[model samples]
Target chain A: MTEGLSEAGLIAVVCEACGAPRTPIGPGDDAALVIAPPRGRQVVTTDALVEGVPLVEGVHFLRAHPPEALGWKALAVNLSDVAAMGARPSAFVLSAAVPEGLPAAWWGAFARGLAACARAAGAALVGGDTVRSPGPLVLNITAWGWTEGDAVLRRDGGRAGDALMVRGNIGRSTLGLLNWLKLAESGWGVDGAVRDDALAAHLRPAPPLDAGPWALAHGASAGMDLSDGLATDLPRLAAACGLVLEVELAALPVDPVCAGLTPDERAAGGEDYGLAVLVPAEHVGAFIARGFASLGAARQPVGGERPGVLWRRHGAPTELAASAFAHFSGG
Target chain B: MTEGLSEAGLIAVVCEACGAPRTPIGPGDDAALVIAPPRGRQVVTTDALVEGVPLVEGVHFLRAHPPEALGWKALAVNLSDVAAMGARPSAFVLSAAVPEGLPAAWWGAFARGLAACARAAGAALVGGDTVRSPGPLVLNITAWGWTEGDAVLRRDGGRAGDALMVRGNIGRSTLGLLNWLKLAESGWGVDGAVRDDALAAHLRPAPPLDAGPWALAHGASAGMDLSDGLATDLPRLAAACGLVLEVELAALPVDPVCAGLTPDERAAGGEDYGLAVLVPAEHVGAFIARGFASLGAARQPVGGERPGVLWRRHGAPTELAASAFAHFSGG
Candidate 1:
């Protein structure tokens, strides 16, 4: 039998271990308080991971991995939104509608996972509400970040001459998801280290959070996370700026772990949690020189902005379709 | 047939109409940005309203009221948390797990109600995420506030003999819930104005957000919202302060709307988003001088704090029971 630590004990443990260094008031009261910025701005965003949908029955989350990984993914997805904005991840609050009668250790592992992710991102789990539900897991997390001065990023600033660039590796999670679900048999013949990593990526994503502010400093005009497939998400930046993206097939970063997959299969894959940006054609050189070096070390001319709806990649034109996870319409 | 607006269009309407006033950056890009405070602190708290649990199918929310009122109550409950901290509500992010195939009009009314409550609280609906669920509505709202310096009020700083004080009316929502549920037949023969007001109180709760900062300014030691009925919640403040509270039963404010109710039921019914405070014997005069007037003029010599587990009120000792809406543990 798992010894169940009450909710109060769980809160106290997390507070002491993942104590905030930046904020003045730390969670003990009805709410937690963060130190307000002087001339800077604060960023906020919210996202949810329902138990059944994203984490299908024995498909994505709960049944496949450790409880800690599920908690990590919960906060990591929201952090991806903060990273999409050119800012430093600061603090977050989690509202969990958990199933009734779970053991104390389960919550301990979950909070530990959240704290580990928060510690890595220089963030703190300030405060949140917990309630019991018969439903599977209805976890909603709201993340915030600090942006210095007026230097914030948006997804609609792409110009007709701007180039669409990815801040990090893509499609690991899509393949990772397939790998986790044991549904992929792509004839890549690459296994061993790469296969395990892809499986791990689906459980815990490492978004290119640092690239956001760096790109903003290096003159990034538009930016967003590549949680949705690039085939759809990149065009969103283009659509926001009233232009089409001309993407080169070979230019998109392909993780060795997800090799031999079709370009559309990977590019249109969801749950990658990577960062995508648009840089003006002239400033592209500067962005490469000063932006992210790890990604730039192996970069290509992925795409450019155009005044048409057709998105060209490789040699063929791809339609600007709805995002991979578009809710109602089955596009 | 109810026409559903596309997610993008709905986002646009919410951004334009429910625009933020306090934050420097409003919702449009990847996230909403708020201007950082110079020397103050930012407060955050989260709460949720499940469809079937808190608001039954044909009772509390969906059946008894308009969509706008439901939206108002959603944000209002979170505002009560900010009020409990003696902080001004600043900004909030809402993550709504709405059912699939809902009409566009539903989202519009919800956003309008959120904006209206935000305007009243001097806060903003900065940003949020909307997802589709086949299940009931699961709305989670996380609110932020700006508190000056280190003036945050907690619920654990009471000394023996400190007077337990309430900021406003109590038991309105509890009785109002009964009125909404058609359970209470404690006939006072009152109709028209009082009847409708009680029902309205349960639908769109107006937390005394003003009393927070006011009480903090006037030498308040401890405070929190009376959300879980005074019987259960006051003991929590007493327990947090390591003392027992002797509340005066007849002195508790009885709403004209909830007339002819038993003292136990009125004071112990939950969902009244009023503020309760603990003021030391010496500073009681100053608290009244600068604190809320409505609670001040009709105040009584409610129970003094004692160093024991026993709490007394209305002549006999009051046993602290779990709130009516205590999620689990069978009440």
Candidate 2:
């Protein structure tokens, strides 16, 4: 669909699909002009999605899934990072390297999806660049947000005795991915409401956008978005804070579709885009009341124990395989 | 070279190569935090490069050129846009997709080049994401800069009587690209100092970083960096300002190596990364004293002359091919 379209034409398609720019300056100039955030600090993050690389696990993202869904996922993933910083998204820029075979309609649909996400996050698609690639389709989004004063959240703020909590449904995206891979159990059924729910989770993750700022305002100690699942991400938080995060498998707020899955499967499967947070013991009650489920607590590493996640089951220390998906690890 | 390295290890390699980030929070966090511009507005832009698509021409950026050169070119091109806006670059975020076959050493060298540019631009490499791709290498850089109040150079600010001027050498990158392709005429020689100069222009474009801000301060009406050559870009400025730009081919500040090329070749060959600026008539003397070369003047359209560039030579109107390499236009 993009056979004879000039680069400018493609850019126009994107700008039109994205509607008007919310900033003082928008696309079509040497650069976009935007109002600087008040409080003199801004949050920035970048993320990318590539064809043939599983958006979890499948070939369908490019070949079957709606191009709009792919677009939503690309922008949403970056938004999750901004949300983790407890910032309000202001604007975003995208660089898409697309193959010649991709229809112009597909590109427009993709832009619409991206625009939808930007609107939902209160961000404007301020600028971007489009180039033709002989390789697989690639989408990279860089998002910027702003926070008030020093109120932004940080991952290293947790301390021993802080309650570790999880918000949003854990393992939901993984369950959706498993369903796409046709690995669901018999009782789970191939086509059902649960499968649909799981599919939605995988395709368009709605990261809890308000949670980070809400938690920060209410005195949460530390937080990070859970993109890599508990087995992998919890330890990162623990290491950052120099404490051991001890969590019980039974307390995990697993997605309803993943009810029959094992604790390990639910804990290790990733791409949930949920918030794994730590709150002072004094604020745990307020945290839970705001919809965060307490997983366990941060503890001081004793004796030769290292600063990392300490898996527990029914009050007993447990050993669990903790391999999470890694890009270069060839997982 | 990255055989057994985990994702975190690869990220660490980049962080180390780039050295300490010049931001409050960088690389290791959910999102980097940067100080906002004092003027309450920012300039933002993005640009991308892909393998197999000519970095002007040839496969060397991945298969032959020093990975560092590729790194420098990627970021430099983006910085060119920020420079066009008369803004001081603050920080940048990069999203890089690497193939498994790319050596870890190559990635390290690439990071060094990127870091060098970041330091030179007075900006920091605050954050990025690295993901493995089964396709050609892709790099996208999003840069941010700050301006004092609304003191930005917009292409539309040119007046009908503004003097058209250019900063830096024109057709230099294209000459360098031609040298790399071994298409330089025999009289131009294959490996002399001129060739080296041209090659450097193509590989590590040193954009006129101070010109935009200086022009704005000196009452220049409008400005933009010439990435796609004046044949394509001048008309954009003219269109934005609702006027016709009349220019003399003899007035272009062509590179020494391009002495033998046709006027059109020198005019239309893209990627010069120079500034095509319009200064008010009152400031033309000062603009020239500051090292800008005057081309001609912006004029109100006469006899239905369209709002675009009007090529002239030896005091007479002339026609030009004006094909400035549009992506997907198949050149």
Each candidate's clash count? 2, 0
- Which ten residues in a row are the worst by lDDT in model 1 chain A? A292-301
CAPRI quality level assigned to candidate 2 from its DockQ score = medium
TM-score of each candidate structure, all chains considered together: 0.82, 0.91
Compare the candidates by DockQ and give the number of the best one.
2
Kindly list the per-residue Cα lDDT of model 2 for residues B87-190, writing each as its tens digit: 87878888877766777777777778787887888877889887767788888899988876677888888888889999977877777776765643333233
* Global Cα lDDT for candidate 2: 0.77
Alpha-carbon DockQ of candidate 2? 0.62
How well is each residue in B158-270 modelled by candidate 1, as lDDT tens digits?
66666777866576776666665453334323332334776667777898898888887777788888777776677677667777556656676646877856555666677
- DockQ for the candidates, in order: 0.47, 0.62
Per model, kept true contacts as a fraction are: 0.66, 0.77
Error of 1 at B150 (Å): 3.6
Label model 1 with its docking quality class: acceptable
**Predicted candidate 1 versus true structure: per-residue lDDT over A1-331, tens digit per residue:** 1236555565555565566432226665677767666766788888876665443322224422456777788888888888788888988887776555666767777777777888899887887776655455578889999876687888766665666777655767776666655543333232222336766677777787888887877788878887776766765666666765567655666567768566556676777787877776667777666543122111223367344334445556654334434321121
